[model samples]
Target chain A: MVLHIMADALFISVAILTIGSAIVALETRELVYGAIGLAISMMGIAGFFLLLDSPFVAMFQITVYVGAVAVLVIFTVMLVRTQALFSIKEDPRRKTAGIVLLLVFIGGIGAVVLASGLGNPAFTKFNKPAIDVATIGKQMVTYYAPVLVLLGLTLAASVIGALALARREDIEQKNERVD
Target chain B: MATVPEEFRFGNFLASIIWVILIVIVLLTLVILPLTFIVLFYVPLPPVNGEVLTPYLFLTMIVDPTRTLPIVKYLIHTTPFKVIVFPGFVFAAIIAAATIFVERKFLAKMQLRVGPLYAGVWGVGEGILQLAADGLKVISKEILIPSGADKPIFWAAPIAFVATAAAVVALIPVAPGWVVSNTDVGLIAVFAILGFFPLIALLFSWASNSKYPFIGGLRALHQMIAFEIPFILSALSVVILAGSLNLTHIATSQHPFWFILFLPISAFVFFISSLAELERVPFDLPEAESEIVAGWLTETSGMIYGLIQLGSYLKVYALAALFVILFLGGWSGPQIFPHQLGPPDAIPLVKVLTLQGLYNAVTVNAIFWFLVKTIVIIMLMLLPRGISPRIRIDILLHTGWYKLIVLAFVNMFVALALIYAGVLGPGGSLSIH
Candidate 1:
């Protein structure tokens, strides 16, 4: 009983943190603060993953999001110093469009929920088996093997493309110098 | 001390303090006291000795001589004790600080100079106090900020770096069942925490809002990301051999033969990648002083610089410990601890030293071998700091991306070969278990 209550408390607190930080990310004035807020929000989601007992996915999320994506965002924001980004003038057209889009998203979700009737108050006890990485690996190879190969190939192709593009830039610069 | 001008009389200040105290007293009595009582009523108290204990009972237990055994056992097994003392921040910090002093002395020997002189210990010139002295110097120095620097990030990044390093330390098992969080995926969690270092470096450099910092940050990003593949790949070879991601399992799997004998290439790859990851010499291009004025860390000074360097050394210790855990048998050695320190029944609570005492004996033995291996690895890590100059960026990237990755792959194949040949596996012909 104590464990259940503690888990519930932890879950609620983590959910609040995720929403609060995400709101801060959107509403903050400073770009760097926004980026920090985003990182915090991502971490809160990782905490949620931990609560869900998917530690591997949680670690992967942290490694990719808080470690790489946030840094990439910071780098881009630092490098690109465009004056237009400093002063975001509100347009009536854009404001109306945003509100309409938000309403549509909300209405669609509400409609789907009402149609499906997912509000039955039945609770099922969670008794998950202890699943380890080997199980996940075996399933990935047997069931999703083609999808795994597809991802690998796509990543390899993109890497080759990026390298070629970089090489081309170097050659073009050299050609310009010679001319 | 600077005197405050007596624009207003001291009597007025004294009267204001009295009013504040009066308000606080009223607030505590009217609001806070009832709230505390309500909370105490709602919360369930844990039972002890067939009695629901209160604060009064706890106080008496503190003075009780016979209660020491249970108290000692609880303290030893507690999370805070493990995290703060053994195999955690304080332990890692002491090792890191010692590394700094010993590294200075070692490099000094290599260069024929007096290193960390005058900061001697009792009857020894080991620079035992040098790290503390340097810490004081850094703390006392002024912190300077660039004009357009992102102040919040500039301050937070170094702290985050240290926290992440400490998080990695928390996962390392110094002995069996002796970790802060004994998660099954401890090894992967270490890699995940380690991934934060590059982000911290980049963020701090970007936060500096200076040209040199920007260049340095980019180099750090490239350097860290490039080496990560080889790092994971090399670790993959070990995972294949052990068939487990738990650091403890990996260690125990190596009882029959250390993984290095069968997977030397992976160990080499792991070592090189770790050196790169730790940003040690010959791979310290991100912070090369000659070309980039200490690279991404150019703008850091005072305590900020101190924190980053401390974090770096902690990482050094962590990686060295990991190397020991993976390639060398972690905490495994011939049992050298005496069967009993004295007559087991001498102690009242422990007739024959008790379960706790026996566990402690084993733990001490494990810690001894673990430290021996870790220190040797640390010395090896520090060797290149004196021997080699930092390499160029192109060569560093090429080696990280191409050579190390290929070597790691080759070892992965070798691991697969061993497993299939039934030479060593979970229940193979020559299984370690």
Candidate 2:
């Protein structure tokens, strides 16, 4: 009984943290603070994954979202001049559009979730044995090989594309110097 | 040079001490005792020897010699004991402290100097107490924050660094069944925890709001992130061989032959990547004292610097232990520990004192070998600091991305070949039961 209460308390606190940090990420004036807020929100999501007993997913979530994505975001934000980071003017129309989009997203997600029967106690109780990492690896290779390959290709293409763009700028500057 | 206040009185000082003691006593009795009682009432007490131990019984058990052993054994197995005392913070901290002292002495010897000569009695102890003295000095010194700094992040970063390092420590297994957290995804979790260090470094440097720190922080980020790929890939070879991500399992899997012999290239990649990740000499651009004035750590002073050092050393221990577990045959040395400390018919007091109930010869041997291997790895890690010069940032990045990754992949293919050729892995001809 005590354990159950503790788990429930932990879940509620994590949920609150996730929502609060996400709100801060969207609403904060300073871009740096927003990045930090986004990182915190990602951590809270990892906490959710932990509570759901999928620690593998939790660790990957932390590795990808907080470690790579958020770091990149913060690095980019820092690259911009400090004066420009905090000097954004608030636009009413943009704010309204953001709120409407947020509501639509929430409604759409809620509708899909309700329709999918994911809220059923039987589905939520985790009666099935937890899938081990080896099984996941095997499935990734055998069943989801195409999807994995495509994802890798997409990432590689993006990286090459970025390099090409950067190289083009360098060449353009060099050409201008020659001219 | 310094003088006491004219109005300062010995009697007043003694009275103040007494008053403080009185306040502590009053608070303990009034606030702490009640709070403890309230918490105890709510907490479901575990059964001891087939009976639920109440608060009164627990107090009695503390003094009663006959019941004490069971209670002590039970406490030893508890999660809090594992996390805080034996296999967790205290153990890791002790190793980290020893590493610092050893590194100082080792580096000094390499550089032909007597290190820390004045900290111990008549220098007979060879400055064994230097770490203690340094800790005292660091604690006593006031923490200074630069003006216009981000106060919250500046304050929190060092602490977060230590906490994340400790989290990594918690995942490592020193001996069989001796770990704070024995999760199935321990290796991945370790990588996940490590990913936070670069972020913390960048945040701290940014928080300092200084030019040197900014440059250092960016270097740290680039170096750490760049090396992370090779680090992960190298460990992936070990994971493939072991067929399990559990650190303890990985350690135990190398009973026949160590992974280093099979995948020396991966081991090399792992070692180099770890050095980069650790920001040690040759890759210490993040805190290059000569060029960048201590890099990201330029603004850190007193306990802040102390905490960061502690965290980094803790990381050093963790990474060394990981290397031991992955490449070196972790805790797989010859049986040197005896079956029991004394004869079977020894005195009860002797048996109790020697912890016969808790003693396991295999565990002792495992822990002994693990520490020896870990220490050797740590010494190897420290060796480069004495001999090598820091590399340029571009060179470091190039090594991490181009050279190490290819090397790691080479060993990965080697591992795959070994697996397919019936040399390693499950049911392999070479795998001994």
Candidate 2: interface RMSD in Å? 0.6
The lDDT of model 2 is 0.93
Tell me the tens digit of each residue's lDDT in model 1 across B185-299.
Answer: 8888989898888888888888898888879889989999999999999999999999898999899889878999999999999999999998889898888888989898999
TM-score per model for chain B alone?
A: 0.85, 0.90
lDDT of 2 by residue, B1-433 (tens): 6598989999999999999999999999999999989877889899976889898888887776546777887888899999998889999999999999999999999999998878887648889999999999999999999999999999999999999999999999999999999999999999999999999999999999899999999999999999999999999999999999999999999998999999999999999999999999989999999999999999999999999999999999999999999999888999998888876677766766676666789988999999999999999999999999989888999999999999999999999999999999999988887
Please tell me which predicted candidate would have the highest TM-score against the true structure. 2
Model 1 residue A99 distance off true place after TM-score fit, in angstroms: 3.3
Query: Model 1, stretches more than 4 Å misplaced?
Result: A27-30, A86-88, A110-123, A163-179, B1-67, B121-123, B347-359
The per-model lDDT (C-alpha) reads 0.87, 0.93
CA error at residue B71 for candidate 2, angstroms: 2.4
Give me candidate 2's TM-score against the actual structure.
Answer: 0.91
